[model samples]
Target: MTGHVTKPGRALRRLLAPLAAHAILIAATAVMLLPLAWMVSTSLKQSGIGLSRGIEWLPWRDAWTNGKETVDVMVLGARVAPGDGGEAVEVGIKSLASRRRFTTVYVPEGAFEAEIEAWRIRPLTGEDETAEARWAPFASVRRRVAPEWGNYREALEKMRFWVCLANTLAITFLGTAGTILSCSLVAYGFARFRFPGNNVLFLVLLSSMMLPSVVTMIPVYLLFRELHWIDTLLPLFAPAWFSVNAFAVFLFRQYYMTLPFDLDDAAQIDGCSALGTYWRVLLPLSRPVMATVGIFCFTHYWLDFMGPLIYLNTSEKFTLALGLYTFKGAYTTQWHYLMAATLAVSLPCIVLFFAGQRFFVRGVVMSGLKA
Candidate 1:
């Protein structure tokens, strides 16, 4: 009955379904990307731009259009000039009333259409009158891109950026390595070894994920303090070595179970010990899951704020997340520099995810299907 629809109806459904899906996806993508784009925009803008009404999507635009800079504009207000039709007068442009719209050019003779083409903008360096060009009035707009690369430099100056960046990279590498190795080991044991209380222990481990990090944060801090590990990266890196992450263990366990037990048996028959089997047989085959776990651990370590803030007192030991807070002061906040620093910090994660996205997704899907 359903297949008995008209050809036009069927075609319409096929067309509409994909269109709707794409529309929704595009909207979701825009929702995510707009803020990042805006951050880039804000970071590139020259500082001291207070809270404005409209959004500045692009950082660089001409003075007349974006109302950002002042230029000597020649307006064509009741003028019978010699050569062409454009006003050439130097006026200090200021966007006072409307930030979203164009600058209010105070025309000396009160011209109505005070637009770009009607006005001959002065050269930025005030050398030559290059405004009288091949432009036939009201033509294509010439856009000038002024990328403020200095924002990144200034942002680095706001905090101990190099030190923090180095610390973050070190912690991320060590932490991810430890997480993958420890989790894989624990997961192999749980997946292969038929030990007593294995199921109960697994259940307990899974349940640990439900508990908030805030619940255990103080106790862990106190323990680390007693061990004199305060203000050290050890406080962050030590736990990964012990496979304290329940979700990572669970993910690894699920992935490991997906592998054929026959492989292990075959390895054992070849005089390979359990450790040998894990090292040679399983480890080689578990690249996807390893990548997944590594990505997770890397992301967590990179974005960790509370952990670093609580443990590290000295600015020298601060992570990127901790160092970023320095941009905020009692009276003012450096939004441009903050955004620039954030973009710089987020770049590594973005690159890593894009590079290993396929592996990460496949690992997740395969783990779910098997267990």
Candidate 2:
């Protein structure tokens, strides 16, 4: 009787468990995506002005520069006292058109001039028309918002953005290709071949992953310098060709090991060599893992800052990661341009990851199942 009553409770828990998990996942995703959404918002925003004011979740249709302005001018025909005015106070034509309000003007700080006098504007029909001038800023300002699409154009124009983009793409493509080819070959050897001390060698490779990259930084830099690879992209992508990434090789090896060894034996029985077996029999089945590794390698190379900073010397050869530094200076930061350039740089990676997401998930799951 108790078991029958418990069955319904178990069923209810099973039904609610997935829903609760999904709700938590949705909240986590939103938290992760908030910064990215804000970055996109800032990319579309106008410029450096008003950034310190507050947070803006959404980009405005147009950013308008609206504020009180004070300007220096010569106040002419001023009355000495109330009801004793011999001549009315006059404002110069220069002051009337002092602002470039015809177009949306962004005055970060008010105007500076060689000469200025605070002049008050009085209504013609007011009782104080004949009174002495009182200094105050007027509200005869026209405010408007114009489309800030120029932020993109300005960001591009400010730096060699196209060059950085091209360099990044070239490096990413070469690094991904090299990593796939080399790591897959290494993974195949580790998964299939039987050699003396093979397991020991593989253990050493995995242990290397525990060493911090900083330990090898100086030696790697000196080696590259000796090879005259510094200041060139060779320092960035050449390492990928050596299967130096233990984690990627480990992932590929695990995935490869999950396949039945019967396929290799069958290929050998058909007079196919070891290399032939890997190419014809195993490579075709490895697409999912290949995609996962490619995606990881692409993103790593694309967003890699420290490597590019250490190796690259010239501005023309800079990657997008290094190009961002141009937007920041000793005293000022161009938040809009920085965000815009960042968005432009990251868009390709974002698209690639989303497009290959299914393959990536399948590869990770299959790889982990075996190892």
Candidate 3:
């Protein structure tokens, strides 16, 4: 009887364990995703309203009806004052500056026409020296969800997004290709060839990874400047051709070592040279590692800011990462436009990661496991 009762309790605990773990994981995921959610929310919000006092998850705007037509308005403030018709309510129409009202209107107490004061501007005419301000009662004002989808369009235009995007894509594709080819060749040699000082050379290469990039930054800049590569994209993608990334080479070499030696022997028996064997047999079989390395290289090159900032002097040659910096001026930063452009720029990386996630995980796992 005790065994039977305990078995049921054990089964219940087993079920609850996974449930509790999943609940915790879901909560952690939500926490991690909160900033991204806020970015999306702020990107859609109207300007000047994004920094509201409270957390607003949705893009909401105030609309006011003046009994004739409804129009969007900015609510300044409200106050109560004495009037001929009972207690009167005073609402400010427009705000010219802090603690100052551009226009004011009076409304009777308990009147549906006057709850709060709000202001909207009319299109300026040639006869008008300034924009015409229209005021309405607070009772006619209603908060509604109105996402400013045009923020993306305006932001893109301001950032010269297409030009930056083209430059970024060019650098990313070229650099990614170079990294894969150069790293794979070097890794293959390290994995398959047996020569004196091979391990020592690889150790030296690995040790280079520990060195701070700042140590080489000035020397590299001088070298590129001498080569007349300054103010050009050459400095950005050119280093990939030399297999500068020790991590990518290490990944490829590990994956290569996991493959059987018999495959190399069979390829040799079939009259395939070392290069042919690598291109035909090993390279084809390294899809997972290739996808992993390609994604890493793509992201690095796509979002490289310091590289572009140092080498590319002209706005026409700017990458998306550097172009986003223009949204911040000496005085004010356009947070809405910045967030919108940031979200737009980050979409490709997010999509690429999700699409190649399976291969990326497989590559990392398989690279770690020895045959």
Q: Per-residue lDDT for 325 in model 2?
A: 69
* Per-prediction TM-score to the true structure, in the order listed: 0.73, 0.71, 0.80
Q: Largest TM-score belongs to which candidate?
A: 3
Identify the superior model by lDDT, candidate 2 or candidate 3. 3
Model 1 global lDDT (CA atoms, 0 to 1): 0.71
Give one digit per residue, the lDDT tens place, for model 2 in 134-173.
2122223222333356668878767678999899999999
For residue 302, model 3's alpha carbon misses the true position, in angstroms, by 1.6
For candidate 3, the per-residue lDDT at 300 reads 90
Candidate 3: lDDT over CA atoms? Answer: 0.78
Error of 2 at 351 (Å): 1.5
Candidate 2 deviation (Cα RMSD): 9.1
Q: Name the top lDDT candidate.
A: 3
Clashes of each: 3, 2, 2
Deviation from native of the Cα of residue 134 in model 2, angstroms: 15
Indicate the TM-score of model 1.
0.73
